[model samples]
Structures are given as structure tokens and as C-alpha cells.
Target: MTAPTPRAILEYGLSSGNVGLVQLLGLCPLLAVSNNAVNALGLGLATVLALTATNTAVAGIRRLTRRDVRIPAFILVIAAVVTSIELAMRAWLPALHAVLGLFIPLIVTNCALMGRAEAFASRHDPARAALDGFATGLGFLWVLLALGAVRELAGEGSLFAGAGHLLGLPGLELVAAGYPGFVPAVLPIGAFLALAGLVALRQGWRLRRAGAGA
Candidate 1:
């Protein structure tokens, strides 16, 4: 097979590394803030911004950074970008900033960000590096949204609770009363169980599809 193009590299990063599904990076905020869709979306957006900025910056300076010091330089760059994002979030989206809490700053330490910077951005052109970051970030966001939906539905018997506050759109509320239980969808244990179940379900679906194709 011919060598994969930069665009293909990015697509693989998103679908394969899969900060949520495969690599399982950034699980702390994934489980914690995912109690609600708005919370998850807020963090996911921040992460995407941080990743894109870091990747681009790193790519731009890759030529100047020496091989021995590249890793530290990459981290410093990522941290600076994440800090800027954190400050912006604090200024404009204070409520979301509050809900996200430490995780906002913690994006600096997220391996997924650093990994992309070191593995992809350092070796690729700026455009491709940025695309890789965007793809990976989007993949991460998708899983966070799905997890938030499942948890919110099970925990509160509703989807998008308090969504108006996040979306800043009026009269867009979804609520379902008579909720049975919240134990399996709000707790840390619940997060683990839910994630495990999702993995198993995906595996089963893949297996079934394979069998059908055969």
C-alpha cells in the first residue's frame, strides 16, 4: 500500500487513538463533568482549542527545537496554550469555568495533547498538525457527548438539564420526571461500569458485523 497522506494520519488519530474509546486518555474530566451535557461540551471545546493551538505552535517551531530538548519545548508550548484557554474561559464563561474547575487547567497535562504534539505535530507540516489536533479533539468530544447523554438520561431521567444556561438559548429545556434511580449513572463507579459496558457493546457489534460479512 502507498504511504498515508497527512489527512489520513489525522483521521486515524481521531478514530484509532480515540482519547475516549482506545487510548482512554483524559478520563477524569470525562467521568466527572460528564454528569451533564453542557459541562461536557464546555470542557470538550476547551480541550479542542488547546490541542489545536498547541499542535500548530509546536509545528511552527519544530525546526528550531533541537532533538534533545523537543519534548520539554512541546510541553511548555502546550502548557502556555492551555493556560491562555483557561484564562479566556474564566473571563467569558465563568459558570462553565466554575463547573470545569481544575480540569480546565489540567488540559495542559493531558497526554493526548502532548502525545499529538510530540508524535504528530513535531514531525508534520503546520496544516497537517492542526488538522490532526482538530480530528483528535473532535473524536474526544464525540465520546464525551455520548457519555454525558447516557449518564444524564439515567441519573436525572432527562437529557440536557440546565442546558439553557450553557447554550445561552432561552426555553430549550428537556426534562423527564419519575426518574427511578441515579446510583448507576452519577457515581465514579457508575462511570467505570458505563464505560465498560460501552466497550463490550461496541465489541459485540463489531463481531456481529464481521460474522455477517463472512
Candidate 2:
């Protein structure tokens, strides 16, 4: 197998290795908070901040950390970063923070962050680790946004329905006033179906690319 180039490493989390659609990491928050675009964006940004900071911190102290204590050290780093983000949100974006609720604190439990710290940040320089975290976070963000948009549009006939809380802007209503939205699209089962659809689309694109190369 060929070793990953810098470009591949940088883009991995955002494309083929997306934590949401590809790796299915952090599904609890991904599904729970993604009922609308604004919530998804809020959570996504928080996750990004947590991941990038934790990865950088881990990489910076990697040499100092003993092998036996590395896992605990990484968890502490991740939790601290996440706690900072949660506090900032509580102070600045209280409405969005309330909407996200327990999920914000739950970011500490996201396996994807731990996976990156152990698999990439520990082995790479701080710059590369930060990039990986940002890229991975972006990958995760896009998936959340897409899933949220689809579910919101289908269920509520609108997009960014809660934007006033996050962005201070009213949401857009795509359908007529009388349009009866599909209720199931915003339910828990809808998240599963929508995510599956996204995964299938990604797989189809990959198949086409492979065939073209062949």
C-alpha cells in the first residue's frame, strides 16, 4: 500500500474518512442536534474547536508524555478543550447552548477526537496535527449541515429554522405557507435514513472514480 501524502492526510477527514458519514463517529450529537441547520452548525463549530485545540495540545506535549500515561493525558486535553468551548457558548450563544444541551459536554466522549489524538497527533508535528483536526472537523461539519438541511427541509419546509438563535437571522421558508411537511423526516429514524443516503452517494462517487481510473 502506498503511504499517504501530505495532501491526502490533510483532506482525509473531510472526504473519504468523514467522521459522520464514513466513520460514523459522534452519532449521538450528529443525530440529536441536527434537526435543523442552525443547531447542526452550532454543534459542528464547537466540535471543530474542540478537535483542533486538543490535537494541537496533544502534539505539543507528545514528547513529554510517558507512553503509559498517554491515553489519560489525551483525554484530559480533549475534555479541557471541550469544556472551554462549552463555557464560551454558554456565555456568548446561550440560546444555541441550551438547545444543544448535554451534547456539548458529550463532545468529550466522541471517539473521533480520541482517534485523531492517538493515531495522528501523537505521531505528527503540531501543525500537521492541527490541520488534520481542522480538516476532520470540517468533514464532520459538512455532513452534519447536509443531514440537518435535508431533514429540516423535508420535515418543516424550511432551512435554518432556528437561525435567530445562532446567527440572529430569520430562517428561510422554501415551501408555500400551506405546505404540509413530512413529519418523519425530522425523526430519529429519519436521521438514519438520511445518513445512509449520504453514505451511498459517497460510495457511488468513489465507484465512478475508480472505474474512470481503470
Candidate 3:
């Protein structure tokens, strides 16, 4: 099949082709660090940076890469990009970096990033590959942001509790100070439940669209 147009690539990444919601890749970090909005945002930004850089580098060097060594080469490129981002974050945003510690380095192992490098970037030009990476990363970012917001609000009765420190935004508490938070919403089980709901919702929407078109 022919590759999607640039606009389609961007649109799909934001919606139907979301790495988190649709492809369902890289759920370990997605679930682990999304307890709050600030952590989610921090990790999401790092993923975006890593994905974009990896795709660009892979696409730029596709011709020079031997088919047999492509997988390892792609992994090396991804590792280098992730390492650079991780180091930069550690230097500039130590607190946020510390908060997202293991996950930052784990970006190199994210199948979503690897999938894009091998499937799309390897076949496309650098400009298009970069766009795909950005779009794909943005898709993953929004899901993390939404899930984190939901979990935080449900579990802590507030949103962006540490935004002032990590993301430089004012923290907002929607509920009274006395509000008893939902313990389950911030737990590992909660991540599974929340992601299930989102996946279901997406599938439902797809069904509706298919029915309408049919």
C-alpha cells in the first residue's frame, strides 16, 4: 500500500492512529508515570523529542543503512536520540527528569518509536519522516495528558497538583481540601481500567463512523 499523505499522517497521529490509544504501544511508561498531569507532560515531551529525532535520523540515513543491519542501526539511532534527550532533561529540568527517571531512558525501547523508524521513516524522506514522528508523538502526548488529568482529578480531587514546579503552571484544585480522593484511580489497576475505557470509546467511534459511511 502507498504511504499516507502528509496531512493524513498528521491527522491519524492525532486521532485514529494514536500510538497510545490506537496502536496501544509503550503502555508501561504510559501507565506508570501518568499518575498526575505534570509527570505525564514531562514524559510525553521527552517521548515526542525522542520519536522525532529517531525518525529524522533513520530516514536521513536509510540509503546508507544495509538491510541486514537496519534493525540494530535503528535501535542505535533511537538509543542515541533518547540518551541525548534524557541527558538534556537531567541538566535543564532536573526535577522533572528525576520524576520520570527510568521511563526517560526507556524511550529507546518503546516499540512505537521503533515501529515508526522501521515502517515509515525507513521508507520516507527525512521531511516526511519528521512530520510522521511529530504527529505520532503528539498523538501519544495527548493521550498521556488526558489520562493523567483524569487520574489526578479522580484520585486527588485536583488537577496539575505539581504543575508550578514541573510544568511552570498554576496548580488548580477543583474539589474542596477535605475531598476524599478515590484511591483506585491513581493505582496501577486504575491505569488499566482507564485505558480500557479509552480504547472502548475509540472503537465505538470507529464503529459509528463505519456504520454511517456504510
Candidate 1 per-residue C-alpha lDDT over 168-206 given as tens digits, one digit per residue, 9 for 90 to 100: 743655788677858668777777777787778767887
- If both were scored by TM-score, which would come out higher, candidate 1 or candidate 3? 3
User: Which residues of candidate 2, in runs, are more than 4 Å off?
Assistant: 1-6, 171-176
- Model 3 ranges with Cα > 4 A deviation: 1-3, 171-176
TM-score of each: 0.91, 0.94, 0.94
- Residue pairs with colliding backbones in model 1 are none
TM-score for predicted model 3 compared with the true structure: 0.94
Q: For all candidates, what are the clash counts?
A: 0, 0, 0
Off by over 4 Å in 1: 1-3
TM-score of model 1 (CA atoms): 0.91
| C-alpha lDDT score of every prediction, in listed order | 0.82, 0.88, 0.89
Error of 2 at 123 (Å): 0.8
